[model samples]
Target: MPTTSPFALLLDVDGPIASPVTRDVAPEIIGLLLDLAVSGIPVVFNTGRSDDFIKQQVMAPMIAAGMPSTLKIHAICEKGATWFTFDSTGAGEVQVDHDLAVPGHYSDEIRELVASSFASHMFFDETKRAMVSVEQNIDADNTEYRRVQADFDAAALEAMIRLGLGVERLEVSLPDANSGIEYRVDPTIISTDIESVALGKDLGARRALNLLSADGIVPGAWFTVGDSRTDYAMADWLAAHGHEVSHVDVRPGDGIPAGKPYPVLTAGDLGLGDEVIHDHAGLAFLRHWRAQLDPGMVINSTELSEASV
Candidate 1:
């Protein structure tokens, strides 16, 4: 294996960091994150959650749960539409870099098309940069969620086709059929300005990664963990840039993209698959990677105690 030390961990909040809805992070997984922090690995939270939402919902809970205070942690939020850095000097201060958030120069026609076709379902939110959040009426209990998703998917597919934005991508996903479903359109489609809205999200993630690299963060040495189609672009970007990508899902096969050659760590069908982070097989892999950082650091023996079971 290629040896690299002090690897940066890019974690996806919903899948690897915390469970959905209940907002509970497993004890063992917390231990693992704590261990990584204690061992001096830099971990960055990369997610679709907004900056304010991540701090309040994810980071705050982790810190309260005895996570290491000295760890060098960073965050890329809003589906890579924003980047924030937390350092020893700043302490609780979060510095935002907006250049990464702006969807590179896009044509006006794409915006008009999105506005006309999905007027009721889509609207622009002015958080970091103007991003269009497409709301889909989905029924989680009934079969309507899937139907709604298909409609949204068809709209995005058709938009992309009409605009001819290759290289620029749009990501359509079922956020949480239980709570609600939302998708994002990109800002820059090649052929038609109308398709740019579908490409906004895909463009944002790519821009964020580019910004990270431009700021001296190497992609090949970085690791990203996530779940869902919105995260697929980031995964694909990392893998293409020679970075290691891991997908963490509560259920092994649930919602994960098919035919991606990356490794996936599952917490089982429900949340029972926590062993993927707590057990020997999982810990061993983490330790092996951490070992490249500091040879003296050791994997906790207790982690693998249940291996025979």
Candidate 2:
């Protein structure tokens, strides 16, 4: 009923929307997302999460909340190796690039590695159709997950090398003298996703744009929200391709990247405290955007002018 929102959202799932600890989205967050969608904003989820996870944790709850069929939402999952769209009826077709998948043996090896060595802290995600992911158990402590994460990664890396596969770990500072690394063992706050070097958030952003175009919708601008450093690729791609965009780092405690061309802001900019990170910050961002879209809304004290970087 309201005019279509001027901005579209490209979002990552794990930290920004879903709680990394519980691996579930809060009802308030879901309500806000439904409001955003009902107002006709294009809400596209781009993440390393599998389509199945998105379907269960995101789409199922949304559908149960009575999402309108008119709202077409797209999800780019497995870091762009797979994707799907859904509306009120249910999920639609899923598209996966088999060529982009890591060798099946790698997933098998990694599964055994997790089960054998890191079962307490992590579990191999079987729902992933393309990339191999080992997620932190919902009950596992974050500190414990981080403690065993590197050992699992190293074991997986050694397996890849044993199989004569060229591989690297994501976010590693150094690349070897040999320049033929093909895949990366990427570790995040609550998971380790081993995927092709080619698969990234940038690819997901491009896919989201194409999906929106296919639906005959063009947003005036875009907002990308994520909790990790890798999530910057979405905003990076949009900015490089000449789109008006801003990026929000829901969790900036790790460190924010320097010298980004587009603006990068956080809930902290909007008067939230440092302790409110991850999904809480994400919820604040959604509220901020929602307030901006509907001028009738009012903030008690904080100035929106101060928040815009």
Candidate 3:
């Protein structure tokens, strides 16, 4: 850890900063993030959201919260395939940084197959640029999305194979295991991303850090917060680079490893308690940091136990 409070924050958009189920961002968290930025702490939202989602769900909210026109924010979207910056004006154009984007021909083929074969189970995201994604619509009468997800993934894989698109399997664990849910390729169960194997959160974090460094604004220590196992990739990358980075798992009981291969602290370890899960817990996590970073707040290392209930 840095001798002082960390200077930058790398956050995952969904689950940590936004509700995965409803896809909403709380106004309080938005205001807190903007205030942190104004306090000279750079915040980089590194996530799998597309540029369009980032603009509507994130940038627009900040603008409404009185973000200055001159203030700039950094974001790594589509996991690691796209990177961009937003000014007080609004979300800017994203630059696709990797050659791993699924070819248009391949994407078209996959889309056609999904639409023709499993239209009821999944709906494709039109805003996606580097990758293709299909979201699952879980019905209250039939909430088993995993079964549909398996069939959909198999079909999508077959389509990719037919198109000679290099493919790989990405496993995502459930946000809360106690919900009696099993881990699947889709962590949120709301969407499953089909992108090149080369793209991931680790790459996004590395790219964001490099970009921030280029601007001569390197952070003393880094902190990454997310609600899924996939989010651990960012912390894994930072630790491998010899940077002091802390990983905060906002999910209540995901059962991720706590040290070595992936040093992590559960949201409960941060005072969120074991029962507070999902977006509410995520909001609480952000609020804790906002208070911790207050100029008038003074806490000793040992006495900082209040940070973790």
Candidate 4:
């Protein structure tokens, strides 16, 4: 058996591992992940996706790629509300933390608001176990889509406040390319997820650690990769705990800084940057890490010399 690495790679399913446009994992990416796991590197998929999606989109492909039975795959899903592990065989039974579910009454009201105000532009996702989500068919240049999403963001905040969650309205933003100084209000144009304020990627990272620790495995170094701005919260949390963190921002220009708490590198900075592409970056990152584990493996080129190990 190969010796496991002290490091673990925590990934967000969408964007970094799966393409945001097609919502599919590339065959090469799946094969690389399987190879990494077999090489004794722990891989955790943490995302806003549901267990069913994880099974169909991630685990299923990995099993087909010959994921070893000895390899254990951990996942934190629906942001931080669901947790589970899968072996080489099939999808594991999921364990959901219902405590993180949005209040029933609040969910009902939010559902009505979306149905009444934004039904045409958005649709409720029933697959969500702990949160209420309305997904918008996003087109970056579409003015109408942006307007409807902003309207939903405002209405959702008002609903949460009226329910006395005591949480302030959260707005996702991005730095404008032309003027790096200006930050634009960019709601998750693809999906707006409303759940308990206690649940987030940061909490998910901790949850993943707790689960792994239960198995007597404590990670030495941690790396997190995601395509969205909110995903930074995970790396930030890990870094705050004094762990060396390597953060890969597949989308880039999310207005977050690199270094200090952890070092942040963009997909483009890693030699796979493309305006609307993502899978290439995912492939490059996995290959880079795999090379680190195998001394015999030679990397043709990379810019992660300054990244936190």
Best by lDDT: 2
Task: Give a tens-digit lDDT track for model 4, residues 1-309.
Answer: 233357889999877887666678888789889888787677898898888888889999998888777778989998889988998888778898977787778778877887887887777777888878877653433456667787888777666545544443454422233323111112564777776667779988998878777777767788898888789888988988887888887777556664546677765565543552355676778878788778998766443322211
lDDT at position 131, candidate 3 = 80
Candidate 3 regions exceeding 4 Å error are 1-5, 138-142, 170-188, 261-263, 295-309
**lDDT tens per residue, model 3, 93-143:** 779865867778767876787788767766778998888887765342125
Clashing pairs for model 4 are: none
Order by TM-score, highest first: 2, 3, 4, 1
- Cα displacement (angstroms), candidate 3, residue 287, comes to 1.2
Residue 16 in candidate 3, Cα distance off native in Å: 0.5
Candidate 2 displacement at residue 196 in angstroms: 0.1
Candidate 2, 290: how far from true, in Å? 1.3
The candidate, 2 or 3, that scores higher on TM-score is: 2
For residues 108-192, write the lDDT of model 2, one tens digit per residue: 8888888888898889899999899898888888897888888888887888778777788865522334657888889898888
Error of 1 at 131 (Å): 3.5
C-alpha displacement of 23 in model 4, angstroms? Answer: 1.3
Reference-based lDDT, residue 189, model 3: 49
TM-score winner between 1 and 2, please give it: 2
Q: After superposition, how far is residue 144 of candidate 3 from its true place, in Å?
A: 2.6
| Candidate 1 C-alpha lDDT tens digits along 77-152 | 6555555664433335544444433233332333464466544443332233323333222212224333433454
lDDT of each: 0.47, 0.86, 0.73, 0.74
